[model samples]
Target: MHEIQDPLFKPFALGGLELPNRIVMPPMTRSRASQPGDVPNELMAEYYAQRASAGLIISEGTWISPLGKGYAWTPGIHSPAQVAGWRKVTGAVHAAGGRIFAQLWHVGRLSHTRLLDGRSPVSSSAIQATGVNVYVAERDGTPGFVQASTPRALATDEIPRVVDEFRQAARNAMAAGFDGVELHAANGYLVNQFIDSNANDRTDAYGGSLENRLRFLGEVANALVEGTGDKGRVGIRLAPLTTLNGCSDDHPEITYIAAARLLGEIGVAYVHIAEADWEDAPHMPVEFKQQLRAAFPGALIYAGKYTAERARAALEAGWADLIAFGRPFVANPDLPERLRIGAPLNAHDRATLFGGAAHGLTDYPTLAGSAA
Candidate 1:
């Protein structure tokens, strides 16, 4: 085994899993899953296995249920076919000796009527999310964004099913040969709906008080742990100060602090935090980020606008245990080696990011590989 000499290449443990370095390939939605329902495909296997040089790979957000899907062509972990599809992916990655995890997600109110089951996306309240769903199409073969529709509050009885969805997804992930699973409780998804006061205005056990609001997330995490059987293998992603897709909560400091502490108590493998949605995030102050670092008390993974240099700084500063590179990894399959040798990075093609063939997906070149 080659020992990493760069401070950024240092080995660390997220629970029982030992990473080769501190680099992480965060989840990026490619929308390439097979049509109708999101199912992993051979292309996905080739894409992920090609990038296995990273310390850890967190797969794109996979819907825990059909209703959890908010966009077109995203993958799901709910069905046997999906499981079989992912098995090909995991098998390829494992054959290359790469560690990977699946991120379980629910879009909550982000879904449009056109995207939902019977045109209903259940959330914590009836509030319409802020900002435009950027993926919406317009007339005349153009594209435009529009305000989100009002979401229905999930009934108290239906909440358990939501938790169960995550549990079952974790089970399916393991069965499909993933090393573990990560809960997509961040980024204004279903779990975030319950955490954000503006989104979750319920008068029931799942809302109001902080404890009540975090109840579903707690259940989901615990259930995933029980299902996956390796606490150190499971991870959770949280955007504590995200404003994208109109996600903002009152008392973010308190809510996130409490959440980090609670997640620590539950013994998850890692906590993936998107420091801020944007590069220069005005929402998350340094003090709040510091507080989260202190409260989380687990393997900390930070993603968003990070370079290898910044990743090294984060590790040296002890603010992040792992650094997840999003766009860089998208265009560079051998990202870790590129950073190791200070090579020029290929810029990602925005046009081909969402739905495309291997033209922009798996065709990115590595230093030693063909540039075809």
Candidate 2:
């Protein structure tokens, strides 16, 4: 197939935005925000601007508040400084003719007191995600990783306030010049904690049955819509089958199919599904994909370790409207162009993947430079 004829290069309408291609740069936490306040810095701005060739750029998981933070150096949207810091990033992307979205996130049970100012993390249930470690700042001001502490379940009345945090964060994202907002409701974060049955063991209205488990996500989705005043500019991400952060459900298809239907009914712009990408990961059944398409009317984005051929096949089969490239985008700033021309891609350095300087962040050579 001709490179131009590849489905990945085709244009598509994503809500109010008309993307030039179906290639998306999904959010990946690099943990490089400025110290003392977890502020987005010029380095981060430059990093994103370098990859502005993507059809849509979703910024790293940004904490909505101090309570939402799960790792050291991850940016936040709750403070004025953080907002100003991200503004530069959004401005940079827009100047390069790209659209960006802020991914609002809260780590829930996947957090430690060291990251939460000595307070226990909050979740739907008082459960500790065993065997999970989060990045943190050591006592000597060095970067380190620590096991997640046990979490305290949110009080029944506290749910509303938690929802409000998402609302406020959405407003902040818009103020920071984001084209839209994507709720980070996957990967065993706070919203994922509520959705997964294994993590949410409460008997309250926010737990037990699947419907109750969905209430938190629904409320948060609604809050983001209300805050943005435009449902078309809001989106949600879900990982129904992922056990990345100790999140699991008895019936992932049932849980996520219903969730997709709810998001479709709410009129969000898109639904991003983060597929399991690890070696030996279980395949997402074809039946589930068809059911999800029927349930959601908006754009559907699938991301994992998708090769160019696999992405084209998914688009050709009408299973996904867009394809997101995560790690590949990390090393190839001009990923769409690289994929278009079948150029060699730089392998990402695992050691410098997180909490790094410019060595692996913005220093990757582009096709033009490499040819020279």
Candidate 3:
């Protein structure tokens, strides 16, 4: 590959912000937030600062409310201290000359009472995500994964409160010094629960038809934009084909195509599509890609098992404006530089992917050190 002419290195404008490259570090749940309050800390700052070379960094999924939290040690953006903690992280990233966006998240049916202070998890419908487990603290404070319990469906009046929570979280993200925010409307979370018909069994206006199903997502997107005071600073992520966390739509193409069109009408900054990456994963047809490109007026970002070659191909094809590297950014803090020079990458250690200290988080060496 000709490194000089690589599209990944080219600059692109995402709304009002000018990105130096097309590479994005999409959100990955590291589960490394500080104890007691689940706040951001200096260690997390160092981790993000180390990978500042990426054109953009979307933070790990953060809960918008106490009820939104689903995993152990994942951070929250609902409190003053949490906001203060994230301020340090944003400062570190900005000082290193990088831009960051907080990924606002709320896990609905994917939670256990252990994580919800004895309150049952809520979704658009009362459904249990079978065969799915969420990370939690054990009896002795050890980290473990437990099967999620059946969730309660939100009442019609309660829908507005959910929207308000997201609105408040967006304001909190701005107060925490983030450049922008991304809605985690994927992977069977609260927003995804509303979007996916299988997870949402409501007969009310928030469910039933595709249009009704998209109501919650539309409300949340508008809330985020209004709270942030900038439509260009807000982005929403959707997974059209992912079965992870038991999220599926009867007709993915119809559901997501309509979703893209709705988001385009909303005039948000961008739409991030999370592709399935596991072995034997279903393929996303070129036809769907074309339809999605036509539906969404804003920039499009694709993530999930993307390699340099595939990323380049996608950019050359003219559909994707940015490509996100999830696990690669976890191990290679200087991933952009490594890709630019075609240097070998450090393999990520799966054991320490979550709930660990700096050993697997920030201890990975750069190319120069590895060569030396």
**Tens digits of per-residue lDDT for model 2, 1-372:** 645577888888887888889999999999899887899999999999999989999999999988899988899999999999999999999999999999999988888997887999999999889999998877786678788999999999999999999999999999999999999999999999999899899898999999999999999999999988899889999997889889999999999999999999899999999999999988898789989999999999999999998999999999899999999999999999999989888999988888868989999999988989
- Clash counts per candidate, in order, are 0, 0, 0
lDDT of candidate 2 at residue 134, scale 0 to 100? 90
In angstroms, what RMSD does candidate 1 have relative to the true structure? Answer: 2.3
Which is the leading candidate under lDDT? 3
In model 1, what lDDT does residue 91 have?
96
lDDT (10s digit) by residue, model 1, range 121-217: 7898888886647354344423344556678889999888888888889999999999999999888888898888877889999889999989988
Q: After best superposition, candidate 3 residue 157: deviation in angstroms?
A: 0.3
Q: Single out the weakest 10-residue window by summed lDDT for candidate 3.
A: 1-10
lDDT of each: 0.85, 0.92, 0.93
The TM-score values for the models, in the order shown, are 0.94, 0.98, 0.98
Which residue pairs collide in model 2, if any? none
- Point out where model 1 deviates above 4 Å: 1-4, 134-147, 277-280, 370-372
